[model samples]
Every structure is written in structure tokens, then in C-alpha cells.
Target: MDWIEANFTDQAGLAALLLAALGPDGDDGSHDRSHLLRVWQNATSIAGREADCDRAVLTAAVILHDCVAVEKDSPLRSQASRLAASRARAILAGLGWEAPRIDAAAHAIEAHSFSAGIAAETLEARILQDADRLDAIGAIGIARCFYVAGRMGSGLYDPADPPAGRRDLDDRRFALDHFGAKLFRVAGNFQTEAGQALADARTRTMRRFVQALLDEIEGKSE
Candidate 1:
């Protein structure tokens, strides 16, 4: 089977084009161009290590994965991936991409979302899933959690139940509960070995932060 990398397409140009189309007009400090670039970087790294994965498909998927961003808690969040997939197909077609490549990229985009509940059937889809999910963990992910929390008017922690032991989990009200709710579960779902390795390391960093925060609240810090 022939891989798309053999065609020597101009990925950098496609990346710039996609970013221009997806990037915000103003600096909102949300998941913008930088986020797409990081996911692209992560996808490329994962693709480099995997066999029979279509680099072109992964690149296109990564660039256009978040083209249609919905709020995390929005009811339409699960549909974001499917909508992005449709948009990506049109974008790739306009850029002269062939049908096979466009379809592969679209499938990858459709399968990358956690809320969408789509299993990755292709290697490109798997890598894209891992790369996107990777952005939701680690130090940057922690910062992003707090960023969303702040934006949504959520407190840093629940004063009465800091560790959330006695209360039901509510990430919407307490930013720290996000770790237990979603971020900690991400590392286990990575598809590629490279992604898993990165996710594991990032998860460890997150765990340490959570522990440190707990200890600080308990006055156990040295």
C-alpha cells in the first residue's frame, strides 16, 4: 500500500492555510493556532514512529481537527468532530487533495474526539486521536483546565471538600476536580506507543500537581 508521504505534497503550505482559516481574529487566549500547531507536531511525531500510517491524512486531520470549536460543556460538543470532518473534506478538496486522502483525513477528524465516542479504525485516526487527547493532559492541560474554569466562573477548589472525597464530582464548580473527572483518564486511551509514553509522563506531572495541591491544603508541605 502506498503512503501519502510519497507524494511530497506541501504540508507547510497546507498548515498555514488551515491555520489562517481556523485561527481567531483576536487574541482570546483559548485553543487557537498554537493549539493546532502543537497537535500537528504531536501527530507528526507519532506518525514518524508508526508503520503504514498516512502522514498526509494525519497532517490534514490535525490542522483541521478543531476548525469548528464548541464549548466543552455544550450539548453540541460531540458533533464538533463530525462537523470538523465535513469542513475538512471541503477544505482539502479545495486545496486539490484527492478523494482517498480527503476521506482518510475526514475519518481521522471524525474519530479524534472523546465526546464523539468514535473508535479509530485507521492508523491515521488513532494517531490524531492520541495527539489531540495529549493536549488535554500535563502542565499545559492543567493550565488550560484552570483557564476554562476561570472563564466559566468556577472556583479554584471547593473549600469544604478540597479533595472531593465527601462530595460528588463537579468540575464545573471546582477546577481541581477536572483532573479526576477527565484528565487522569486520558493517558490510558492513547493509541500510539509514542503518544502513550508522552501521555504517561504528562499524567505523572499532573498527578504530582494534584498531590501537591492536596498537601498544601492539608498543611503537609515541607
Candidate 2:
């Protein structure tokens, strides 16, 4: 329990430090503090039931998961995971966490992102992965889809050009293509039953939303 408290306390401190460094406005204009908070909440909910999971490691991963996001200047460009691990390692070491736990927490944080191409190897990483993926599917997920799509200059739907091959995705494809590509796969990838259920329900909603959007765009909505 003491370790958990210390890890979380250090996590909060790091979050504050990173937020200050990123400024109150955030890097992506869209990824505000509230968004990070939601990811943390979702991760915590999933982490709570995993008895084999370490609370300190999971909590630290959740809070500092996006510390280095897609923002920031060059030299530091696209180095969120590296920067996060460095900072998190310092915090963990300061709290007397041995090398293994610090390494585990850093791995979880680094692997939490789908774009990172790193798979979750630990129980804590699996839980964090599911929780983070859950955030990309629900009502909030819908919002995030458009937010990210807009950022990437992607359209909402492309009726003529369907997402056929798995390997041909580029920046201009429709937002719905993401579901077929990866979002729907999350339900089966979750580590916990609760996380699986949440992913299933959210995936369904996302599918329905995509269908509705397609229908509306095609003037075929009922």
C-alpha cells in the first residue's frame, strides 16, 4: 500500500510537471488535460480488478502514458515514450522502487499506444492497453475519432473507396476505416472480462455510428 501511494503521488507530480512544460493549452489543441484524466480514470477502473497487477505500476503508467505525445519541438520530436520513461524512471527511483518495477512501469507506459507497435507483455501492461483502447471506442471514442481524423485531415467516410486491404492505410482514409482496421479488434485483445465487455459494447456503438454516418452521407438513412 505504501508503494502504491508513493507511486501515485509521484505520478501526480510528474503529470503536473509535464502539463506545465506542455503549457495549459496542450500540444494537439485537442488533447487537453481532461482527455488525459479520462484515460487515467478508465485505466484505473480496469486495473482495480486485476489481482496480479501492481497498483503502483499501473497507476504510474496510466497517468504518464501520454507525457510525450505528438507535440513538442524537434530534437524532442516524437519522443514521448522515451521522455516518459526517463522521467518516470527518475520518479520511481526517487521513491526507492527497484529496477524491475520501474522497468515494468516504463514498459507498460511505452506499450500502451497502438501506434507504438509494441505489445503489452505484462499483466499491468495488458490492463493499461485495454483501458486505453476502451477510451477510443465509446461515446468519448466517437468524439476522439473525429478529433483525430480532423487532425489528420481524414474524411468522415469514403463511400466509393472502401478499406479493402489491411496494408494500404494512409492519412486521407475515412475515419470509419479505423474500425475495420483496428478498433473492432480490441474486444478480443483485452486482458480482463470487464474490459472485454466494455470494448464489445463500445465497438458496437462505433460500428453503428459508422453505418449511420455512411447512410447519412449516401442519403440512405432511415
Candidate 3:
């Protein structure tokens, strides 16, 4: 919370973005606030090691990237980032931001999505992409994965085919399948060296978790 002012140059602009993205009051008591804080921290840490970046723009992108939350099971899931981007553009414009910086923030917000498949062209965009994906692995990622799965009414895993040994993966139906479907392969796409190192470490944690989960599923763990 204190880092909000410490990390970026323009406290007022950053605060406006937060209000626009997170609502006027901020963090209506959900995991959204925690997730935003983690991504912001990740972005700043990566930016600190890098040569050049617009901290204010990066902060705006981080806050508003998920401004439009589409449920994981929604048919419009793939468009979530694009929708957020469109909204971000308008929000930045309303805040009287210049054209170029607004575009930069909007692009970073949109390109950060895994399903969007848009390459991150700018340093800020790459950092944002890496930072956001960093949150999708490791221990916190495991917790969120199962939490969303439960919300979606998915089982832990198919008991008879825990690893999808016989059938293909269906993350929508089984929580563990999500690890293989996306989380396991996330590290290879990290854009920055710093992000890559953290991603690799987190990925190892996820793999160990999957193994442990499989062991429990088979009653192989003591």
C-alpha cells in the first residue's frame, strides 16, 4: 500500500488509475486486491533491474490490466484482456493522459493476457506480461487454481485418470489438469531475465505440487 506512492513518480495519476480500475473505494474485499498488489510488486522489482521504463505507465497498466474481469468459464474469456484494454484507453483518455502514453498503457494491459496471443512489444509490456504470468504459478497460483476450480464446480481431478493418462486434459472439469494445461509451461515464455529466473523457480514449486497431489491421489504418499 505504501509502495503505491514510493514506486511511481506521479502519485495523483497513479491514484486516479487505481480508482478507475479498482473502483473509487479500492479492493471491495476480494482476492483482486491481493493479486493486484503482487503483480505491482513483481513489475516494480523487474523494472528496478532494467535500464529504462516509465514507472507511472507501468503502474497504470498493472492496476487496470484486469479492469474488466471475465469469468474463466465465460465464452468471452479470451476477449477479457482486449475488453480491459479498450476500457483502459477510455479511462486514460478521461484522465487527460497524452496519446502515446495512453496507448502504451493500453497495449501493455491487453498484451498481458495468455489467451490474447499478442506479443509484448515494449519493455513495459513485456514486464507487465511477465509480472502477471508470474502470479499464475508457484504456491499462490496453486491456491488460486483450486479456488477458481471450486467456483467453477470442478473436481480436484478425475480419480480414475488423475494425470489424464488415458484421456486428454480438461481443466474446466478438473483442477489438477490446469497445471499441465498451462501453469507447467508458463516459465518458458518469460520475457525478462529477472522474470525468467523467478518463473523457473516458481514452476519447480508447481511441478512438485503436482507430483505430491498425484501421490495423494494414488495413496502413495505417507
Q: In model 1, state the lDDT of residue 156.
A: 95
lDDT for predicted candidate 3 compared with the true structure: 0.84
What is the total number of backbone clashes in candidate 1? 0
Model 1: lDDT to the true structure: 0.85
Clashes (N, CA, C under 3 Å) per candidate: 0, 1, 0
Candidate 3 structure quality by residue, lDDT tens digits, 21-41: 557433322247678788888
TM-score-wise, the better of 2 and 3 is 3
**Cα error, candidate 3, residue 212 (Å):** 1.1
lDDT tens per residue, model 1, 1-222: 333344547577657766776646434345777788888888888888987976667778998987776877788988999998998888878877889889899999999999899989999999999998888899888888999898788999999999899998899999999999889987788888899999999999999999998999989956
- Report the poorest 10 consecutive residues by lDDT, candidate 2: 69-78
Q: Between which residue pairs do clashes occur in model 1? A: none
RMSD of 2: 4.2
- In candidate 2, what are the lDDT values of residues 1-222, reduced to their tens digit? 665565455456655544454445555744567777777777777766777777667766776676655642235544666677677777668757788888998999877766566878898888888888888787787887778788777886665655434356443467777777666765567767878988888878887887787667667849
User: Rank order by TM-score, top first?
Assistant: 1, 3, 2
Query: Which residue ranges in model 3 land beyond 4 Å of their true spot?
Result: 1-17, 24-31
lDDT (Cα atoms) of all candidates against the true structure: 0.85, 0.70, 0.84
Q: Assess the local accuracy of residue 5 in candidate 1 as a C-alpha lDDT between 0 and 100.
A: 48
- What's the CA error at residue 140 for candidate 1, in Å? 0.9
